[model samples]
Target: MFFNTFSWKEFLLRKIISLLTVLLLVVGCENNKKSLEPITPEDFLIIAHRGASAYAPEHTIPAYEIAQQADADYIEIDLQMTKDGVLVAMHDEKVDRTTDGVGFVIEYSLEELKQLNAGRWYNSANPGLANKEFEDLKVPTLQEIFSHFGNDVNYYIEMKSPKIYKKMEEKLVSLLIQYNLIRANGELPKVIVESFNEDSLTRLHQLEPKLPLIQLFYFKEEATLSVQHYNRLSNFASGIGVNISSVDNDFIQEVQLNGFQVYLYSINNEIEMKKALNLQANGAFTNNPDMGISVRTEFEK
Candidate 1:
């Protein structure tokens, strides 16, 4: 009886040990799999620069709708604050070029700005593709844009002239939270804040750590970034946007190696789009999103 009891005890012990060994092996395999996974550059993002500005007046509802049809990854909006502290989409500080209004955007109240003809300028500028529906398309407030698109589309928002608008960052964060964009979980939102101002970017990072930010750089001449510059930017920004002319294969590789995403901006043609792709840019901001999407699709094929 004693011998039988001992044999049974030994068998149970062996089974327990074998089960633990299998579990350990499984856990180790999972860890190894994760470790060995390649860090692929993010899937190419075709950001519509001011909502397919090539086809329609920029920063208007019509422009955004057309961008959606073109299958852009994100609708880029340049935010400028009005006198009444309303955030509106306008790329330039002055409204003379894009709208009938001939003053700084900040000088007009949102209501006054809405009264201006935002679309007529486009029709006049591009008579070849003019549409009657483009007439009287009012300047859209940032809130209006969010309400119109909701979670259906992603936003690449730029805090234009952050230094000029002292409370822009606070107001932006508040609006983002109000829109249910600030979540407790680490999941990325459909919004990304970008600016040429580092101070604004840093303030944004402080307000919402989970929200990704991009540092935008504009260069008249070709530019090269040092490791220190990449590291400094990485401290506050998840990625960098550069003029398409300023970036090359080495620049993209260096930035990616330092774990920062690189995006080339204002690429409106097939040749530049192909060059951006060849450099393995995470994305490119394009006035012609349709062209960018087509080139990307063909490249993938």
Candidate 2:
């Protein structure tokens, strides 16, 4: 009887060990599923600020072409008006900062704006990089950008001045339609329109409810306002676009909690670039698309 009892005990012990092993195997599979899950950074996009302005003068075909060559995911184009009320790709309402002109872009006709030396200012600080290879480069129209680089690159168009708010959405949508950028078959160019003037974006949303819109904010207390404003604007925006100084994981997380993405602007340095990635930002606007691409590639490795 003692011998029989010993056999039964040994059998029960073996069954308990086997059951524990099976449970562990099931738990291991569950853990693997969690570990192998996909993350956002894997598909994060890169936007070239002002058409890779670090390599060439901003908002010109030469600059945009460089952005494409650098493999940027999108080329940011800021829009302003010419005297004739035509939309042109430019950062400032005034041409004094980046061109050889002395007044507001709207003051000159397209013919007059085209004649100024757009490449002249580039030679002052970056002579070696300037070389005037693109000297006398003329300002390009919204239509011209689409004509020259259509469908080949994505665009991040910012309606710079709300003074043209009346015609801004109509003109932009018309051109995008002309170029077939807003696809009928669901192949749109992934255009993202941004503006500090919330009403401008709201207007676009009213016009084309499907187009992605971003709410841009810039303030002295940039970091603090980033969260507060993004929360308020989330009702109308798909994402938040703010100065690089304003981006942080906290802001990004807060934006994400509200079901919005984040795009940080004008980051050109290695430190800030790395910070953007570490924060898992949805995208970055950079003057050097090549630098952004290279660092992003390295970090993934």
Candidate 3:
């Protein structure tokens, strides 16, 4: 019969093409890694806050790729676990703001969450930057991000509502190991973990001390910090990630003096970017990485 006549030539060609495609994707992400080196304290890095978020929907692949294209040092991901225990990229505790869905993000299973339109809200919010392409963006998982970017790109993952999401630390560590981002002795980890909860960061530190931790802070009174406070946090975290407005020259000086790197968050304008660089901050998380890079390059001159 005609069906019994097998084509070894076609089969071999299909396998070769598949193999080439996978290899190319890896190479492409590698080439996109402008700052392949793990960020050291001395390095002044511009982390893409939710991946050039001002241009594309936050926490989506298009935003991440655009940030990489802008040559940012890192892509920051805020994780929220689904009902089925899959970790996905999300910022707010509720999906109402980011997606065409209502209710807490944790209540939805991965499949249920995938059904929501994660990017349409961005178009309505920012019509000037709207694109039909972004309207269909899906919420990505930690495994997916790791698979897409590989080890070449840096990952700055922020754990949200750590107390509510029990076993998050364990799951994250397992995933990091699974992705081969975990480094051996004397090798810097490809991933850095950040959170506002000291206990969560401490737990993560215990799970993997090699992975650098960043302690985040929010202040209603003021952004002032005492040496005693710094000493307390220094035990588990290598650096601090704070609101840009919460930090001033004095705050930056204090942090640097105490041997901690300062990273200002959500910096979206030239003034803020210039302020961070001029203040000698170790890093700045900006929603516009291209502008951040451009401002830094001009400032260095």
Rank by lDDT (best first): 1, 3, 2
Which regions of candidate 1 fall more than 4 Å away from where they truly are? 1-42, 183-188
For candidate 3, the lDDT comes to 0.81
Model 1, 173-202: lDDT tens per residue? 888888876542223347888899999998
Which candidate, 1 or 2, would have the higher TM-score against the true structure?
1
For candidate 3, write residues 115-232 as lDDT tens digits: 9998999999999999999979899998999889886677889999988886999999999999878663233346778999999988998888777788898876558765456656
Error of 2 at 153 (Å): 0.5
Residue-by-residue lDDT tens digits, candidate 2, 80-131: 9887878998888899988888899888899999888887688787877976
- The residue pairs found clashing in candidate 1 are none
**Residue 209, model 3, lDDT:** 73
| TM-scores for the candidates | 0.84, 0.81, 0.83
Clashing pairs in 3: none
User: What's the true lDDT of residue 61 in model 1?
Assistant: 91
Residue-level error in angstroms, candidate 2, position 131: 2.7
C-alpha lDDT of all candidate models, in order: 0.82, 0.77, 0.81
Q: Show pairs that collide, candidate 2.
A: none
lDDT-superior candidate, 2 or 3 = 3
Q: How many residue pairs clash in each candidate?
A: 0, 0, 0
